[model samples]
Target: MAQKKIGSVHDLQTILQISQALTAERDLDRLLWLIISACSRLVDADRSSLFIVDQSRDELWTKVAEQTTTIRLPMGSGIAGTVAKEGQTLNIVDAYQDQRFNPIVDHKSGYRTKSVLCMPLINSSGEVVGVIETINKKNGKAFTARDEQLLGALCSHAAIALDNARLLRQDLAHQSLLHELELAHSIQQGLLPQSAPSISGWTFAIYQSPCEQTGGDYHDFIPHAHCQAVDVVVGDVSGHGVSAALLMSTARAFLRALDQDSTRPGQLLEQINHLLVQDMADDRFMTMVVCRLDESGHVRYASAGHEPPIVFRTENGYCDENVETDLLLGMLDGVGYAEYVLPPLNRGDLLVLCTDGVFEAVSPHTGEVWGMERLRELVRKQASVGASALCQKIMESISDYTDHSPQKDDITLLIAEKT
Candidate 1:
């Protein structure tokens, strides 16, 4: 059927009203409903439907005009699909005579169909982005050329409105996600220790940097049942972001709760492993070092698949203590842990506990990792400095070696020196 140039003043006015109304609606579903309803009234049709093109799937999908349910059909499968595929206006006089018309919809709805005005919705880029189909003219006659022209104009406005609504929805979702991440970052920061512990006859310093807003690394200075000692814990969960932060929080709480029962590093770790194994996911685990330091300079510690602590002695220089590691926490239930008592610390000795992040930091310029050997050598050189100064120097060295490469993981360092 050919399009007629003739249109009434009323039809033009109606189209203008629909264009303004469609542009005002930002919600995609509501905008689609308004488009279909207005198009049906403009063409004096009994019903109408709007189908959006999904180029990736090569399909046309539409929500049922009167219901929340949706229906989909392959492109070029029916009258609407044909118009969309060819990017042409379809004015059918006899629906059943057209082989492209599918009667299954009519049979399912129990409504007899005689004429259809299907038009492709082309955007500014000349791409057919969707289709609009008006069904069964009310007068029981073949739809005229005047009806086709009116619907085509209306569909042009509808296409732009649909595209605007989709972009708005995407922007809103992105903003919502950013807000959530910001809130999570704030909470994760709050869980960390605010300041290093003030223990008499000892100096303490700590450095922690997370790769992202939230991370898996955790460190805590827990007071022991015996007022003479303090337990220092440093651990790393398996991953980053909110899940890992949550796991770190849980581990901190568990460790603090067990502090009242026992200060023995190995026993506390064994109990924590049992609790974590009961709830943690099978693929997730944590590596940690738990050390208890008393005022008398005695140090007892345990490791759960964590990095060994380097003890810098005034007389012997740097030595990596042979702390025996058990299975990583959350790996299995009923795992046993061993505790090692180091030779009592003398005056001017430093004990360093750190996560792998400190030693594994990658240098962007040289493409080299700040390996454990460099860390040991640096610790040996800085042994004479105060614990606080030593920690700052180590962090500065890493920063210079990496040449300001973005941190790739969570880096943590805890240094204790007998002054």
Candidate 2:
């Protein structure tokens, strides 16, 4: 049976049904095919094709029409492309008479060309995203103004549906990635030390902050030989985030294992460096400081391309012991490290060790870094306070200096004081 003409009240009902179906579709391919089919029915056209604009390639492409398996044309090359490019609605009475009509499609498909109604599909931003082309009215008449109006309205609904589907997919992918990052953060936190170790004749305080969920900064305390002394280690991996966190964990394990065999800071770092060079990636490395303090306040320390530790004397004020350093760990195998034994600390003396994140923190407004000079002044001011209080004060000072700027790296601080 022949189909009824589309100008009746029944046609309006059919259009409503098509709109509902198009809005409900979440799959892009199905939605596009529905748009082409629905518009063809609404205008009583023999065939229709939907061409999506590929902005990256500057082309128009489609795979949803009969007699066209897949087609791609440069923008403004054919009737459909011209409508997409100009953001216009074209109603042609005779396709063969129009120079814009390409006869190659008719020749390939063995279908005669007659009339066409081509309209641009515009998104909410008023930008053309695609084109809809209807070919050959079923009654052998050219497409009328009424047909153009109906198809244009349906295209409006279709455009909204396509944009919604794209946004929905992007949101889902973003949510999934966030969940995975959070999980990695939890695992990295679990790898860190739970509490500071108790050492005779000394009080220790520590603070760690990562710019992201996971970070590369690490610190640890290992007891030496029947708790006669404690070894403190602070390190910063080359980068931030999960990969850096993994490298930090590896360095931590290697240092701890090497500490079991040696109490000398230089030997321990040298052995750990040998292992890290074999295990770490070529571009990856770590800056680290290791210190061992005995019950008698004797301090032995070594540095591997890390910031020197600061010592605050109760009577002499602040002094940045700019100790000499070796090449950073993981840079080369069999590298030797040098250890410095500082004069035995007196009671009430405070030592501060930190990662670059503290001294190099950038101010939000001024872009100035909280450099070592400011850190020395802060340490001198807080030297008389308890180790825990001093740690908190330094963190507060850093926060004030940066003025809540987003952190750019991982920060780790360790404070050791003679009781």
Candidate 3:
């Protein structure tokens, strides 16, 4: 049967008014309601719906009609979904007789759906973003060709409005996330030692370089209240970014609270490890080293799978690599850490503690790792300099070796020189 031409000047006016309203509205929910209301009024239908395409899930979703519950259907599964998938207008006089129409919704809601007119809401790029569906014409007749033309015009405006609203929401979410990261970075930085501690007969030098706003590497100097001994700690948490930085902060707090003059370095680390294993996730872990240095140049240190300290003996003109290894923290409970006493440092001997990033930095041009041998040679040559100056020299060497490649990990160095 040929379609009835029921065109009217008032219909054109209604579409123009709806377009103006949609252009001004930015809220997505309100905009969707406006579109659905407009669709029902324009076509004189019993009910109407607007389903937005969710490309990520390969589905079409709509909210409203049932109050809180959202309706989702696979692409090309039903009348509205088929219109969205094909980017075409579907006008069926008898919805039950049509092969593309799914009557499950009618069965569930107990509402008879005799006629359905589904139109694709296409963007300026000719891509269908959604579908405008209207069911059961109020006049006891199928929707005419004039109704389809009016709905198509309204849908064009609705698509543009939806695109703008979605983009605004995405930009706002991105800005909010960036602000949160900035706050997190600030808090992590405040947890670190601000300045080197002042002590006679010892010069301390420290530096930390993070590839991002925050890093997993941590270092601190905690002095004993009763004795002249000072504890130096350097830790590297696995991975980078916010999660690693959070773990680094937690470990720092645990170590500081457990630290005592009577407690050995190994005993302190064991306590911290047990706490971490209980609190942390299975994939996470930390490698750390703790060393206590006295005014008399006597030292006791312990390692938890961390890189051993490089000792520069000024008299012998040799570098002593004597740090014993053990299992890293947060891997398993009941793990034991061993303490090793280094040969007492004579006058002018320097001890260097660092994370793996100090030596494992890769060169972009050469594709080579600046290994331990290069670091040992550099320390031996720069043994005569003060602790602070030697740290600066090593950083310079690392910069030169990588040829200004982007740093992939956190770099931390703590140098203690016996004066």
Candidate 4:
């Protein structure tokens, strides 16, 4: 049980062999076990533990404990934690005499602790990534200064190896997640209306821009062949990215399947709202507007906490009117939606529905928003153009206003013009 002088040639060779073993293993768990094994054998300790830092939780956790059970401790608590926090070495001759020692672990494990030596594992960037704790030296003596030096050398090698392995694991996980998101984005794009609804006397233009691989914005035009009417809907989920994209997909499916009945846009929205409330989380909801246009040029629309569409009327001195707003979807069950009738559009009139991302876009340089007024002005000026040209011109204006800064949210707009 006597500790051998680490300056000996055999001990140096053993250290070299341990370093090789540590470097060979890339799996974090196996590498951790190797580290503890090397520390126990090199220091002639009864048991050893390696605690890795979890910066997100600000805690130290051991995956390869002597008892084969995981242990978590606050960053600055206990002997191991103190060493990790201060980035210093601690050698305690008597565990019971040390104020920093927590006896709860000893009580639970039924292990009598005597001498303790703990040292920080600092990465190349001079940051403490973890700690090495060796408990109860086999000879029943305090860990010597020589033990600290030898263990410190081992920790230096272990830290760099551990950091590299951790980075690789994180990169692999991130790549996997990105691949899944890209696949989901592809699937989500297919869920949207593949082609704009082709109706006589009407021209439709649709556009969507997602800041991330996935977005919360959704739009679709479903035509009723029997009724000779088209249902146009635009909805925005609470947040952007994966969660919102999933919810958007669900809503799209529900809308398609449930719109088979001959209900008005308001009644259909109420039905969709009840279904969304059951599926959405409490913190999440959606803003939506649905409008049905008949061949006779009659347009009846219902809104759910969504922004009003801009109606550019050439007959009214090129002015724009915003439709009445109402409560959003998925916020409350049994909420009724009121349908409003818009004046039948004459030739060259425009109806534009959009999510907030379009007008609320912030200018990167000036920190000013391209507000609703600017959007309304742009629509009025461009209203005389074809439906596709109008949507394109508005998108160009937004790009110029924001100076092409990275988009923060999903942008969507649907323009329907009476030709």
lDDT by candidate, in order shown: 0.87, 0.87, 0.88, 0.89
True-vs-predicted CA distance for residue 337, candidate 3, Å: 0.4
lDDT of 4 by residue, 1-419 (tens): 24454356667898899999888898887898889999999999989999999888999998787874789999999999899889999999998999999999778877788999999999999999999999888988899887887898899999999998998899999999999998999999999888797887688999897899999999998888888889989999989999999999999988999887847989888999999999989999999999898877778899998987778888874654655877888999999899899888888888889999998999998898999888888887777787899899999999999998888889998999887
Name the best candidate (by TM-score). Answer: 4
Please list all clashing residue pairs in model 2, or write none if there are none.
none
TM-score of each: 0.85, 0.77, 0.90, 0.92
Model 3 residue 291 distance off true place after TM-score fit, in angstroms: 1.4
- After aligning candidate 1 to the native by TM-score, how far in Å is the CA of 172 from where it should be? 2.1
**Highest-lDDT candidate:** 4
Overall local distance difference test of candidate 4: 0.89
Clashes, model 1: 0
Candidate 4, residue 138: CA error in Å? 2.9
Q: What tens digits encode model 1's per-residue C-alpha lDDT throughout 11-45?
A: 78889999999999999888988999998899899
| Winner by lDDT between candidate 4 and candidate 1 | 4
| Rank order (by TM-score, best first) | 4, 3, 1, 2
Cα error, candidate 3, residue 396 (Å): 3.3
**lDDT for model 3, on a 0 to 1 scale?**
0.88
Off by over 4 Å in 4: 1-7, 314-320
Q: Model 2 TM-score?
A: 0.77
Worst 10 residues of 4 by lDDT: 1-10
Where model 3 places Cα greater than 4 Å from the true spot, the runs are 1-9, 65-68
